[model samples]
Target chain A: MELPAQTFQVTRADLVRYAGASGDFNPIHWSDRVATKVGLPGVIAHGMFTMALVGRAVTEWAGSPDAVVEYGVRFTRPVVVPDDDQGTEIEVTARVREVTEDGLTRLEVTATCLGEKVLSQARATIRTAR
Target chain B: MPLDPSFVGRTYPPTAPYQVGREKIREFASAIGATDPAHHDPEAARALGHPDVVAPPTFPVIVTMAASSQIIEDPALGVDYSRLVHGDQRFAYTRPVVAGDELVCTNTIEDVSTRGGHGFLTTRTDVSTVGGEPVVAVWARYVIRGEA
Candidate 1:
């Protein structure tokens, strides 16, 4: 079965809320001063936080979250989340790479940040509903 | 500074079983903005042949991170938490994690090394049920940024 692609935007408030909820009180995600001091151009989002959004995109596309059997991603660049009108948006494109005899579908996933690849070499295996 | 090589193969005690719950899965899915019905409704999951609402793939991070504390808090490891950053993450799954499955994680420090003026630490956490049925294995790599 061919699945459609999905897009998502991560707002500044989203990053703040995730930091609070995940107990990852890293200053780089919320404080500009600390971020700049740490050599980043500005406050950057957590890599795992961004990766989690990729998982969301896949699950939402498959119409079932439990369908995902395996998911892996490598963070290549930091998503500079600015506190402004232009929110950081992630566009995820997924296609059915292959389907196995056991009812598992391999999904090739790509997540881009502001037109640049933030996550590379991403893939997921999902067991389809019979 | 050389890390204790003996720590490489040491496997920590298994964490207490974490019962997968529907509410928690929904919370995680919502946090990531996953609007899939199979993550929030048991009926939808049952229709898809799952026992109950299942968690998103990355949901294993919650358990793996908890298990990683055993390595992070190891005083002999001499890890500086403040300077560490997540480098990479990968997961291999044998099956989907369904609600009501009691899961435990056994964490092992796979490797510790220093190269090009940076320290790299890799840990693998195996998640399984009480009956030894494997669910997923999470591999996490962290890099300690060099201080000026």
Candidate 2:
């Protein structure tokens, strides 16, 4: 079974806020100069920020804030956020891979930016809803 | 420089206990635009059976990042921070992290492999309560890029 895709919008401002809240003040995530210096296209979203959005999607789908038992992802590409009102969007979707007898549901997930996959081998396990 | 493969199976001493704070969790949730009440309100979280505001699933990265830095920055480990990129991340939780919990981490080098001049370093962080109750185990992989 497939879950509804969730889209998240990210902006330069969001990156700054996340940098403060997460304490990851990496220049690549905030300064275009640094990102470009590192050969990145531009300021890129932190990989953990993308993972957190995916986690939000999972918890929303599970109907419980505390339902996730496991979550994982491989960062294949960076989500570059431009310095503009219309920054970028991340679309996340998932498929039910398995539902175990022990009340766990495993989901295979994908996250994309600009129609390119940003995350791979993404998966999450949540407690089966009663 | 490629990380030392011999570091696999090596474990670091436990980190100092980290107190999971309600305001910190809220700040993180808000920063990510997560407005879920369970992540903010103790009453809302209690309604869901959690003792206090529940941390979003990826929040453990806050602790593990500091804890794992002990290994990634170890001079003997030979990890080049400037050339490293996150390759993978994972977390397995016994329960949602809540406010007022003091968590500690023990980091272990799970794998180190070199391919095509790129170095892959995998680390596992075992997180538990100061009282010794397990909470979460986090794994992170970093790729050390070779010079172009």
Candidate 3:
């Protein structure tokens, strides 16, 4: 089974909010100057922030916030958040790889930005409601 | 320079307790646009059998990242914090974290590798109640870029 695609918008404001909430005050996430100096195109979203969005989609698909038993992802590309109002968008989709007799679902996840893959080796194993 | 492989399997002492706060959970859920009442309302969480507001799946990172820094900052590891980039993240949860749970983390260096003039380090953090009831295990991989 495949879950519906979910999309999320990431702006400089979102990055700032996430940084404050997560206490990951990495300047590469907010300051274009620091980001450019570090070799990024511009401000970029935190890898964990991106993973969190995908995690929301996973739980939503499982029909509960507590359904996730295992989740993992590799940051293959940076999702650059422009200083503009619209900023960047990330799209996530997942295919059910296995459904165990114990009501666990293994999903292979894909997240993309600007038509390019941002995460690889992404997978989640979730407990399903009986 | 590659990280010293000898450090693998080294487990650090448990970190100081970090009390999960409802406000923090609410803040994180709001930042991610997760509007589930279970994340913000104790009553809603109770209906779901949780003792308090439930944390989102990725919330454990807040605790584990801070805990893993013990290994990353080890002078013996020689990690260049500036060149470090997150390579991967993983979480395995025994249950959803709830507000007011005093959690402690025990961190371990899981792996270290080098390739293409870059260093790779992977750390695993086990989060549990101060009483030792396991909550979650987090794994994070960091890449230290070689000087150009």
Choose the strongest candidate by DockQ: 2
Instruction: Write model 1 residue lDDT over A79-114, tens digit each, in one string.
Output: 999898666888888878998899888988888887
Cα deviation at B78, candidate 2, in Å, is 1.2
lDDT by residue (tens digit), candidate 3, B1-148: 6789999899999999999999999999999989989999999999999999999999999999888889888998889888899999999999989999999999999999889899999899999999999999999999999987
Chain B global fold similarity (TM-score) for predicted model 1 against the true chain B: 0.94
Off by over 4 Å in 2: none
The per-prediction tally of clashing pairs is: 0, 0, 0
TM-score of chain A of each: 0.91, 0.98, 0.98
Model 2, B1-148: lDDT tens digits are 6677889899999999999999999999999988889999999999988899999999999999989889988999888889889999999999889998999999999999999999999999999999999999999999999887
Measured over all alpha carbons after superposition, the RMSD of each candidate to the real structure, in angstroms, is: 2.5, 0.9, 0.8
Candidate 3 runs further than 4 Å off: none
TM per candidate, chain B: 0.94, 0.97, 0.97
TM-score for all models, in order of appearance: 0.88, 0.98, 0.98
lDDT over C-alpha atoms for residue A14 of model 3:
94
Q: Write the per-residue lDDT of candidate 1 for residues B1-148, one digit (tens) a residue.
A: 4456668878999999988777777877777777778888899888878889877788788778877988988899988888888888988888778789899999999998887767888899999998999999999988877665
Q: Quality of candidate 3's docking, in CAPRI categories?
A: high
Q: Candidates ranked by DockQ, best first?
A: 2, 3, 1
Stretches off by above 4 angstroms in model 1 are A1-4, A61-63, A95-102
